[model samples]
Target chain A: MSRRTSRWSVAFVAAVLTSGVGVLLADPHLVLLSIPAVVFAVYPHLTRPPAATLEIERSIAEQDPAHGQEVEVTVTLRNAGDRTLSDVRVVDGVAPMLSVRSGSARHAAVLGPGTETTFSYTVIAKRGVHRFEPATAVLRDASGGVTLETTLAADTELACRSPIRTLPLGHTARYAGSTATTDSGSGIEFSRIRSYRPGDPPGRIDWNRYARSGELTTVSFREERSRTTVCCLDAREICYRSSGDDSVHAVSYERAAARELLDAASDAGEPVGVAIFGVDFTWLAPATGSHHVATAHRTLEDPETLPIVPPTEWDGTPDDAQARELRTRIGPPTTVLLLSPLLDEFPLETARTLRAEGHSVTVLSPDVTTAGSLGRGVARLRRENRIDALRRAGVPVVDWEPETPLETAIRRGERR
Target chain B: MTGPIAIARRLLVGVGAVALCLGLLVLFGPPVESAIRWPWDDELLLVAFFTAALLLASVIGPFVLIDDGSQNQNQNQNRNRNQNRGNASPGAPERVPSTPTPGRELERVLDSRWPASLPPVRRRRIRRRLRRAAIRSIVRTSNCSKETARERLERGVWTDDPVAAAFVRAGGGPDSDSSRLRSLVERIRFPRRARRTARAVLSRTEEGEHR
Candidate 1:
């Protein structure tokens, strides 16, 4: 940005006034006095603003920091154009989600050609992948008559992924491990006795029945197989609400919780998938492997899939459409571990619909509602009502508070 | 520097400088001892000097002394833009867009639109939302029909908090003497009445939850 500071306009006016009075009075000495004023007025216009060419690079001490850890950021601004910048103000672009714990991100200095200036700031690490924005550099001329501002691009990011831990999936922990199915298969639990076929395993044959009745029979047992649990995240705009402006939005908490669930499920060697409903519906099919787990983590971390920024305009596709898509993608056999804030009634309705579809749905709602204001209080109560409704519908609702440990909330939900 | 305007500006500066120098020489230099020096020479020099000074003032005064309204407006606009941009600048604490909570509506009404000042349609809408929520809360806890919950709400038998009952039932029915007395008390206590009513409803819902 180039702007004229209107320097010495006052001196220019004074010079004109002095000259006018001197001419009217015919006093040569008075005219001579105005000469100094005239010089002061024209001095700034005599020198042109310097060419400001600068390059800035930012580096973080810990690229992948633990949650709440203080990470130091160093910014280096180099005067690359072989021209001296008199007054340079540089504001490093820190991710909005992270707060500066100590030090200043803004610095002002004068830089000569080939000379560099560095500033360091410390920011408290937050959950999520925070990418640094372009730093804003404002350069002012030596005379302060002109100012130029431009953004310096640097590819810097702090991927502060919270460590995952095993979470109790409430009553739905059955899905965390192998579940016994009613169908007869090769398992420990006896299902029934059937007439023996030639291909039947010899060990499965009921030799006692054969001896007693002179008929061959086979014994069947219930099938014990791992159930797939899809972490269906409600990233709808409504779920982006937070209790306060400075706090992380509910979607972030939900995202963190979803990752924990995915990690636990994969650790148990169960098939796990990730689904998100926000700007658009995203689905990752259930499978069991390290590659599958990595893919699920990538899906969870992808901003396009689950954006840290809330959607500006709703996708317009109603909740039913998303629920329908999720239902179709995740058949009845898959357990749905829904992560939502329950800010509105849609999540509750979706949970009920999913449960009605014969999918074992468990709701893990991060409580982002607060009692700061009467309106917020009402919002909290309304959220409580939704949670109550979900629980009454037999969908175990783990009402998670972001301030509390996720495991503690799950344990509380299990007790409930 | 190459534009026509720039060229004209340079020419003006040159002319002004020449005129200033000539005026200074005429004012301070030794007097001309020429034979043609007339009696009115001093007066003529003064008139010429005054004319040059007036011309210079006319040419340069407006440029330097006067403020440009358009430029000032642009500066103000730039200032506002800078402030707005600074909101997301480096080191600015992250802020999420806050969604309006339900009680905010009633809080607005109670704080700003008290008694009969609010538009009937808006007041009714606020009332309906609160009433519906309270009814659902009652029904959820007591396992009663919606109608019964609503009936209890209107009858002021839903909760022991009279102010809450009255706030919820505001503009719902005829004003009995006792109801009028409560409304008077509500008016006296004003802004907090709505909040109290919300608290009462929440508490009632909690009571049923425990049951």
Candidate 2:
């Protein structure tokens, strides 16, 4: 605790000096004036602040909350000493990123021995893990002449989970894979009957048809095989736009869609890989496993890997260098699922180039453009035209709306 | 700091006490002259008695006033404490309460509102906030990432608008030097429009000067 002389004390000293001088000059009036000063001087000393006896504790309502949810926090302070504490102030150390939604995180009260006070507040949680710092307490004497400050360490952590959901995939595979194929083969789903060859197994023979027509025939079943797939997400700056608050930026949607596709591919025992283009080129070769799926999620979720900001300038049009890089990284029997907002011509050109390289390409374009303004309308028209051009080139395009869920949009597109 | 009124009151009280002492001395002077043999000795004896009475009054008068004032103050304080306790929820911990300090409240406000993670210096904070805002706007307008925006800014790609680039290069870290420029940049409603207007004004002024 630190102490500073109060104005009352100073006034008393001045009064004493004046009275002494008056006495030396044989003045009785000055001696009368000094009486009040003496009383004021001694009054504060009679009732000084007591020794340290304050204790503090803090509690949080929820340790982990969903993103955008509010969490309430309470801080309690008690004085255990015999002397009354006239003034106490407490400030709770809230995380920087999380904003206090309602109520104050600070409180002040006067307490006697064995008395306590509590303050409560609420904060809106954000994505990621947040840790609370210690609470600070400032105590003062009744006279306000002395103050003692201390920090009460109460550490707590809150973790918020991601809001995105997994996406669904269609049964059709452009390339050979372990997943079910449309082609007829020896599989669970029935296909068609055909003329029996010499090498045909007897179990595949259609006995009922054979008995009716007096001919030997074999039944065909749909084939089930795994295909190598690559999910490429466009992290270009153009894809960072969002049309609504509930909707994330186009790049985030793309990442979510790619993650779902990669996870589905991995679960189906197919070799799947991921690539990101725009801010900085990143690629993971096609591989299938739980580890690979986790790796892909980490890469897609990494802000550094897929930056929210767009590049200031275009690197160049989709040229031979980009096509060469694609060819080098991706080999045949690999189907490419290109996730982009397709805001600019470069993404469309890149898709066409990838298709030209004989890869079965499907573009999952997250539509971030809104026709609320003339500029946005023009941009939307341009995007539609690009999608049309891609469709004309025989590439299936899923024009995913920003507000629509990825699973619903992909399923609807697959039906078409 | 004590106000003028308080000082005036104290001065008035001192003068009144002195006047009362002088009056008492004058009232008792004749009685003292009748009792003493010497004429000057009577005045001295009266003065001494007046001084003693004044001294006794000075001590006793303050004590009585102080005792009465303290009693009232204590009663009021106890009432307030009881009211405060009643306001709190039942079974809640007792609290030591005090009025909020204005200076400390202001400090807390500054601490909470200011970006603590950023550089502590005011000019540096301004520079960083402005730079980040400019970069974000560039990313939005140009459809580029933060890296590309920073690169373009450093290279002066937005030559049509030099304020942002100039701000980046304005090396002074002191608030006195940077605040004016910071405000100027912040006030630009539409950067592109402001740039065009600035160019037009400069060209018009040049033409007028040449003519």
Candidate 1 similarity to native, TM-score: 0.65
Judged by DockQ cut-offs, is candidate 1 incorrect, acceptable, medium or high? acceptable
Please write out the lDDT profile of model 2 over residues A101-193, one tens digit for every residue.
788877889988899998888876654445565555666766655556666666676555333232333336433344677889888788988
Q: Which sections of candidate 2 miss by over 4 Å?
A: A1-225, A244-247, A309-323, B1-211
Per-candidate TM equals 0.65, 0.40
Candidate by candidate, in order, the iRMS in Å equals 6.7, 19.8
- Please write out the lDDT profile of model 1 over residues A1-416, one tens digit for every residue: 77666566667767877877776675566776888787777766665576758889888999677767889999999999777888898777676566777888889999998899898989877666676767777777877767676677898988766444544553344434357777889888889998988899999999988999999999998878888788989988777666664567778778778877877787778888888988688999999999999998888867677766554566466777877888788765668888888876777888888778788889998887777655666777777777777777888988887656677778788888
TM-score of 2: 0.40
Badly placed stretches (over 4 Å) of model 1 are A1-81, A100-103, A114-126, A154-162, A167-229, A262-275, A279-315, A318-333, B1-27, B30-103, B110-125, B128-132, B135-157, B161-196, B205-211
Model 1 clash pairs?
A1-A149
**DockQ per model, Cα:** 0.23, 0.02
In candidate 2, what are the lDDT values of residues B1-211, reduced to their tens digit?
A: 2665456556766766775665466446767334533233355565665566456556655654565457435433433332222222111112111111111211222223343322234335444434544444455445556688778667766444555456544352335456866655543322332233223323332343355
